[model samples]
Target: MESRELAYFVAVAEELHFGRAAERLGIAQPPLSRAIQRLERRLGVTLLDRANRRIVLTAAGEVLLSEGRKALTALRSAELRARRAGRADPRLVVVMKPGGDAGLLERVLARYAEHPDAMEVEVMICGIGEQEGLLRDGHADLAMLRIPHDDPTGFATEELLTEREVVVLRRDHPLAGRTSVRMADLAGENFPRWSEECPASGQVVRDTGQVAQMIALGQAIAVLPESVTLTLRRDLAVVPVIDGNLTTLLLAWSEESRSRPLAAFVRTAAEVAAQARPAEIGA
Candidate 1:
């Protein structure tokens, strides 16, 4: 069907309420309801299961919701690529969280610069869990992401480095002096939550910097990749979390990206990762 129909279906499927979906789409409930009815009629299937005070997607609706999202992503990517093609000097936009690239970002940039055909590189530091969305929607040509923290599905990724996890705590905390600790040791401690969209247990904070501040004030602790320890303030103590999941760093790009500069940058990143020492990279 049309993009607008897909958009309407997606909105209603996600919200499960016509009034709420209409509000989100900046329209009134009746028109939104009509659009869904029209879509169902065209497809000759019941898309939604409607009952007293309840709404749920039918099997058909589920399929449309999944495929519609992919279609929208593809459409957006096409528009962005077309717009970028008209620019005088093409640049590859790389998105990542601040200080999230292990220690390979600078080395990768320097190595890529040596290539005569390399395009200008623009680094966009974004919030936690935002890298994937940026790359998917064509806001970025590439992104540096860590496993478990960022999902890399639907994109091609190159593994850069893997590092041990560390827990950042206040210097005066009971577990601060330990050489290493297990996850169970900090079970009851306050862990600062990063994003409301993906809620984690314990107290909530905006970003790692805020997590650090909270730790310094004895408000909360954080379990993060070892690389993050390099930026921690002196008042914080970092202890290895022996049983925590290892964080794997990856360079991710949309499967649709075919730019020569983008390909060159990916090659440089892999080469740099291969030669770099894990300790030096994490430090």
Candidate 2:
């Protein structure tokens, strides 16, 4: 399908409202509707289920939405990479959440600079769940983030460090004095929701500081990477989450990325990660 048609479908699918999607795409509603109708006829499959005047994606639509996003991102990446190819001075952009690198970033950059092929590096501090998009869209040359052991990511990555999580709560909370606590020990305690799919959480948190504030106010407790304690407030206390899940802080980059500078940086990061595994090293 044409990029314009695919983009239109994606917009409509995300909004689930023709009017809002048209407004977002800067097009009239009638033409948008016709474009969708024509696309459905051409594809010979009903993408959206228009029942009871409500719009919902059909099974086929869901597959397209997932794959279409990748296609669009790949197309954008090609354009960006092509433009960078013609530039006189090419630089690398690294994206990560604040403190996501587990104190390895500064050292990594320092080591990479000593490499024979190192170039300019720009660091982009992003919010939760934005690193992958930035990398896929060619806005970032590399990323350092944590993921579940079983999580499947299509990016090219190298395992950096794996550590158990910790629990952050109000300094005066009852559990703050404990040496450690099991995941089950947190029962009935408020937790911040990192995403809509996460379960058994109270307030939705958009950033690290917001979650820290939630814990500082005694409104919520968060299970996070141990490195987060480095930035915790005076009113916040961190305790080892003895039985919490293991999170791996890894260096991630696009599968399509094949620059010499990118390779040098990734190798430097891996070398740095090897020597920096902290006290807890089971995972």
Candidate 3:
């Protein structure tokens, strides 16, 4: 199917109303309706069900919507990646959460620079959970992502580092001196919720800086990757949380990317991460 038809179908499916979808698409309702009908006929599938004056997506419609979004994203990403490749200055863009690199970014870059295929590596520091989007949309060529899969979330990844997480709170907190704490000990603590989906008491915070600010004000405590401790303020204290999750650092890039510079960087990162010892948690 044409990308335009897929886009029309997606808009209609999401809005559940052709009129609204047409308005969103800056087109007339009649044309939008015809486009979707044409797409359905071409695909030989009933993509939408109109019953009792309301629109609902059929199973096939749902699948198309999901797949269509992916196709659109892929197209856009290809455009961006191609544009970057055509630039006079050859470079690679790598995205990551600030202070979330498991202490491997510096060492990785240093080692990768010695490689013959190395190019200028531009680091795009972002908030948590944002590296995925940057990579998906081709705003970045690589990322130091903290996910445990080799190919989860549609990106090809190589395992880089694995380390435990810890809780950070104000230094004046009663349990700050403890070398280790448990989930039970943090039961009553006001941990900052990094995203809106978290079922926590306080307003959502977007990054470590925000979490650190809240912790300093005694408004929040946070469980974070131990690598972040190096970036934390002196007033903040860390205690290893026994039940915290193990964050695995991965070198993530597009599955379709075959750039030699990108490949060399990934290989260099994997080698460095494999040889580097895990950072110790100090009391």
Candidate 4:
């Protein structure tokens, strides 16, 4: 089937609303409706179950949607690789959130530079929960993401580091003086949430910086990786959360990526991780 037809079918399948899908595709409703109808007829299978106010995917539609996404991702990856090949200096883009690398980014980069076949590496700092999308959509070659906070499915990943989590609170807060705290101690506390556009869960805030500001102002508290303390303002305090989940940092790349530079960088990351201090690298 043509990519365009697959695109149209996938949109409708995901949105489950013809009008919304048409709007997303920047097309009129009538044509989008006709296209889906034609596709179903061509395949001799009913793809969607349309009711008065609801739409659901049929078994065949579900299969198509799953496979279609992979096909699109592969196509985009090919296009991006082709474009990069034409560049004078082919570089691999490694995406991560600002201050999310747990102090290992510099070491990883320096190690990668020692490789004979290493290409220039570009770091793309994005917000939390965005790294997977960037890698999946072909905008980045590799990413450093925290497990549990970020899903690691559909890609290959190597664990670089893991650290104990800490709760960030105002220095004047009642529990801030403690060396460590339990999750139960902060049960009633307000936690800062990331912005609406970000997929992160919690009380709504624009960014990590804002979360810190809010904590200092006594608006909320947050549980984060211990590395966050390195950049915390003086007004804020980090108290270890003995019961909180350990945040693991990982280097992830798409399974479809065949870039030698990306492989070299991954190998370097593993070496750097191996050489890190045991106390800093966690269990």
lDDT value for model 1: 0.87
Per-residue lDDT of model 2, residues 156-250, tens digit only: 88989887899998989999999999989999998888677778568776688898887777789988888776666888888998889989888
Of candidates 4 and 2, the better by lDDT: 2
User: In order, what lDDT does every prediction score?
Assistant: 0.87, 0.85, 0.85, 0.85
**Which one wins on TM-score?**
3
* TM-score, structure 4 vs. true: 0.89
Q: What is the lDDT of residue 42 in candidate 2?
A: 92
> Residue 183: error of model 2 in Å?
1.7
Candidate 2 residue pairs in clash (backbone atoms < 3 Å)? none
Clashes of 2: 0
Write one digit per residue (lDDT tens) for candidate 3, span 213-264: 9999999888887777767899999999888888888888888888999999
* TM-scores of all predicted structures: 0.90, 0.85, 0.94, 0.89
Error of 2 at 279 (Å): 4.1
Once model 3 is optimally superposed onto the true structure by TM-score, how far is the C-alpha of residue 141 displaced, in angstroms? 1.0
CA deviation > 4 Å runs, candidate 3: 148-151, 280-283
Model 4 lDDT tens row, 1-283: 8899999999999999999999999999999999999999999999999977788999999999999998987888778767976789878899998787777778878878889879999999888678888888778889898987888898999998788889998888999899889999998788766556544345675358778778877888899988886677987888999999987899999886677888989988888887875356422
